[model samples]
Target: MENKQKKIVLTGGGSAGHVTPNLALVPELLQHGIDVHYIGTDDGIEKTLVHDIPFHAISAGKMRRYASVKNITDIFKIFKGTKESKRILKGLKPDLVFAKGGFVSVPVVWAASKLKIPVILHESDYTPGLANRLCIKKAQKICLSFDTADARSERSILTGSPIRKDILDGDRAAGLASLSFSGDKPVLLIMGGSLGAQAINDAVDAALDTLTQRYDIVHLRGKGKLNPGLEGSDSYRQYEYMEDGLPDVFAAADIALSRSGANAIFEFLALKLPALLVPLPLSASRGDQILNAGYFEKRGYAHVLEQENLNALALVQALDALWEQKDEMVSVMGNSKEADGTSNVLNVIFENIGVQ
Candidate 1:
């Protein structure tokens, strides 16, 4: 008799950070003969990004840290989402549910717990996000990207962020050809997440001449943030974003300037890409990026530049210093034990699902 094919439901959204890790697992899961389904908010970024898989959309409510009138309405929305998610889970009857922390996952996690389905929650920061904090009690296992993260329950396991395997197979020649550049100088890649960083964007543009003189610049300037006037510069290239071509870009880059998001930084570490991290300030975030940057900086894998101190001159100076120490940074990253967590995370999934 043929064995039944195991199925898994992945739920997470709100931002790219919450979705990418789930995506990194899809191909691997499919290869292992596991059927994959994803649950996300109808209007969330996950809906757009998880097109390759079977996607179910449910209404999700944001759990804001601060009080507001929407809180009352959102409570109803949360209840509604939970009800919808429960129905979906009942019909799918998946063997396991894996959630990456995001507001959208809260409803799905609650539904899974109520139905007595095994669920694993992955947190990608030094501290648990509000969503994961609420879902911890219900999760059978919690996977953490940072070892220092507070695990309220003994079920938590420190598994570094999962990085997509394809990202590591980039071709340097193809990457340079994509930008129509000759390998005359070192390439510096600047990225500020998917939405782009306004401060970093402005500083990069302002310091273009200074930067271009020392390195070939490849900047992912965020959507709608490109300067049309700077289009034809020989040593600089600007892109809003690249999906399939990103790996090649990584292959082409010698160093990187980026925001210190856990998923992105971990990928950089896995790739051994020397970076100068500029974390979002406390005014903009909950200081997770600052903590992420500080951890890497202390480990000698990257350098940190506080967002508040960022400017054209400061950016230029930091890059220069980062370049000087690039070899050492790469060495530390190569030696780091927490580089990739794809296999560790997969082990958790298989263990919980009773798949040997």
Candidate 2:
């Protein structure tokens, strides 16, 4: 008798960080002949990023850490979303579900639990987010991107974050050509993530002349954050974002200055890119990025610059220090354990699905 085809339902959204891991799994799952599907909020980033895959959008409510006027209405939204998710799960009858941590994943995990569909949740932070904490009991396996994560459950497994394969194979020549850089100087890539960082942008922009004198700068300023005035500056290029060209840009970079988001930093580690990380301060975030940065610094993988103390002068000093130590940083990254979790994660999924 022939074996039945395996089907998987992946759920995560709100930010690109929550969705990219699922995207990393898609190509591998397809190669294994497994049918892949995504469940996300209708308006979330996941819906936009998970193109070419069969995506199912269901209503989801944000689980706020602070009190908000919408909390009352969001309670009803969660209940409604759970109902919708359950209905969708019943129709799809998938063999398993994989959830990356995000508010949009809560309803899908709950529905999968009630239906007895096995779930594997991936937590990318040192601490579990509110969404993942709620879904912990429902998940059959909890894959962690950070070993420091306090899942405490026997199901938790430390599997570093999954990274796209193409990112590791970027073409330096192509990257230089794409940016119209002469390759006369080292490239310093600045990325503030998909939403951009106003503080970093301001500081970098203010110190552009100083930075441009030392290196060619490729700045991903996030969506709508490009400065029109800097368009024709020598040894400087600014882009809102890059989809297909991101790999090439990475290849061309000698060093990086970035926000310390877990997924992004892990990709830097995997690619052996020496970076100076400026974590979002505790006032703005849950301090997860601070912890992530600290971890990398402790491991000698990257240098950290606190956002509160960062200015144009401080940014230049930090980048200069990082550049001076770039060789050591690259060596440390190379000596560390492999950072790509794609295969390890896929093995877990296959084990749970009874595939060898």
TM-score of each: 0.96, 0.95
User: What are the clashing pairs of model 1?
Assistant: none
The candidate maximizing lDDT is 1
Q: Mind giving the per-residue lDDT tens digits that candidate 1 earns over 1-356?
A: 99999999999999989998999999989988899999999899999889678999898898787989888899899999999999999999999999998999999999999999999999988888999998999998999887673543489887889888999999999999998879899999999998899999999989999999999999998899888989888999998988878899999999999999998899998899999999999999999999889988998989999988999999999999999999988988887767878878998899888777
lDDT, candidate 2, equals: 0.90
Q: Can you write out model 2's per-residue Cα lDDT over 1-356, one digit (the tens) per residue?
A: 99999999999998888999889999989988998999998788887799877989888887789889888788778788899999999998999999998988999999999999999999888778899999999998999877663544588887878888888889999999998999999999999988889889999999998999999999989898989999887799988888878899999999999999988998999889999999999999999999889989999989999988889899999999999999998999887653868887998899999877
RMSD of each: 1.6, 1.6
- Please give the lDDT score for candidate 1: 0.91
**Which portions of model 2 show Cα errors greater than 4 Å?**
149-153
